[model samples]
Target: MDLDVAQVRAFVRTAEELHFGRAAATLGISQQALSKRIARLESLLRTPLFLRDGRGVSLTGAGQRFLRPARRTLEAADAAVASVTREERPLRVDVWGHLYAPTRTLAQVAGRAGTWVLGHGRDLPSVTDALLDGGVDVAFGRVHPPLRAGLTHRLVRLEPVDAVLGADHPLASEPSLRPDQLSSGVLWAPGPLDRLDFLHRFADRFGVRARTASVNLGLAHFLAGIAEDPRRFALLPADVPLPEVPGLRSVPLVDPTPLYAWSLLWRTGDGHPGLDRLTMACAAEARRSRWLEYDPARDWLPEPPPGSTAQVYPGSTPGGTRADAPAP
Candidate 1:
């Protein structure tokens, strides 16, 4: 064949993402060069490979016909080349401090995927570097890494992060808790980097008048205080079903803004098949579970500091860490 192996490899990637921009990024080539390679391949193969449109890109029949064999050939090439490079690279799943629950959930679901969730300690600059360098397959927390670089961004789920408090607390009965209601009280929160500053934007919206004091507060301490005193509170995803510690309740914020959102991420290059497959599986399962809060009236958990790492509630498994995990 007149076509080069790189061209064939580009064809395979382009077919999968169905976009030249993504295909080039994944292949780590200029889009113009990638296009020329495809064009050259079309000329050599004597067939139109793609149907480009203003909306996006798609494949022609000839391109579709070549897809499978091209993929197999390229994969085989990688396998052979990988023999020299094939070391058991640890799967470092990136997670910042704010994403404790999601990280835990991913660990549970990735039981069969040879997964290890690495806590990145909320440093996005270094974390983003690790991601692009293939040091970690995924990162699950708030990040504003520059776009237009090699990346594929996908919003996994926008959870309504909120604070859970005891029902006996004065603000618990209100339609939505105000910041001022929390200002006079202790807060359970994460470190400075993990704190959701956007939540403060609503302080003005709801006339709550609140601000974070101990920015380094951990989740474990936050929950401990809430568990010990009815007056203490902690900000959390409204969907989290905090386990019963002794006396606690979940309060939704009148604020519609999400405390923060988590995303599924990978390098701009062609993500490992296994990584994409596993991540998509976890995200789909997470969406399916909905992770709803059971009831605030149960009264089992206490508020602790944002630095809290202790499992306030056990989940629905035989050995769940959550004391409130559903009976097996």
Candidate 2:
């Protein structure tokens, strides 16, 4: 059956809102018009997309199944339009933190092409979503649980993390930190729980409680936190070039130091001309730089402690038993 982009858009908007009046208002259409559009979509598919009742509207099984693919189609449509209309806009590469490796690589790629832009995600998950949604052509992030399918990433680097401490703090002068030494301070890692879960789980294994606070992935927040309280510490990537903050220091974590495995995430089937060129450039750059190949066998941090609060991912070593780590 032939598909209608208008009808598909109406269905997606309604599916998101789950309320006909709200969706219609957001779509700038009358309720009757919106209803007709959805009806046309249902007719094309020969299925009831939603179940309507006094309680409200809810997606039927068919609607639930169609929602994801429909969203992808809409995102693609938007991306295509933007690419054509916005000639002045440079292609964007999204990164979460202060990592320059991806930028450096993409800059080399852009030199061969045209101008490119650098975008930043609040955390790993957001950057991953942006890549999938076509908001950004490429991203630098950690390969962890619940990564979206149909996406591919290259292991660019394994970043040794540091314990950020206030300059006057007693342990600030220490050459490196151990989990035991950091236990006294409340370890404040930035970003949402999901993005930092690996660090949390690893720290839990060593009896250090790592707490997370949602903040913009920028240097301003990191410096402000340490300035407010000397005891506040954060786990940050060591390899990224960070501007020296007067009152803060980044010290390597020892005694089973945690590593942030960085990767270049991009949609596998996306065939943007720039992305294709960027991918080739990135591969050549990675080959020359000898980017670190993450080995699941030995690269994993110690397993989560028994009965840890967070969920342990499947195909992982729980409580120190060896298991094949998930492939990146």
lDDT of each: 0.56, 0.65
- Cα displacement (angstroms), candidate 1, residue 84, comes to 7.4
What's the true lDDT of residue 44 in model 1? 93
Worst window of 10 by summed lDDT in candidate 2: 315-324
Candidate 2 per-residue lDDT, tens place, 1-328, comes to 7788889899998987999999999999999999999998999899999999999999999998888778778766776787788744455777765422345434545666555677745467777766765557777656665667868765444556677788877799998777678776766666554456655665676666646464754665555677566777877667555656777788987655665655567777665556555555554554555444333433444332244243323212212211123323
Please identify model 1 stretches exceeding 4 Å from their true place.
Answer: 1-90, 111-121, 144-148, 166-168, 173-189, 192-195, 202-205, 215-217, 225-232, 239-246, 254-259, 290-328
Summarize candidate 1's per-residue lDDT along 1-328 as a digit string, tens digits.
6558899988888887998899999888999999999999999999999999898898899887787567656655765666688743345577664434666556556765554557545555666665654446666664443443655544443456566776666677766654455666655444442334434433433444333334345454556565555555666766555654555666665423333445555666543545655555554454466432222232112121133342322221223111211210
lDDT of 1 at 126: 63
The candidate that wins on lDDT is 2
Among all windows of 10 consecutive residues in model 1, the one with the lowest summed lDDT is: 319-328
What TM-score would candidate 1 get against the native? 0.49
Best candidate, TM-score:
2
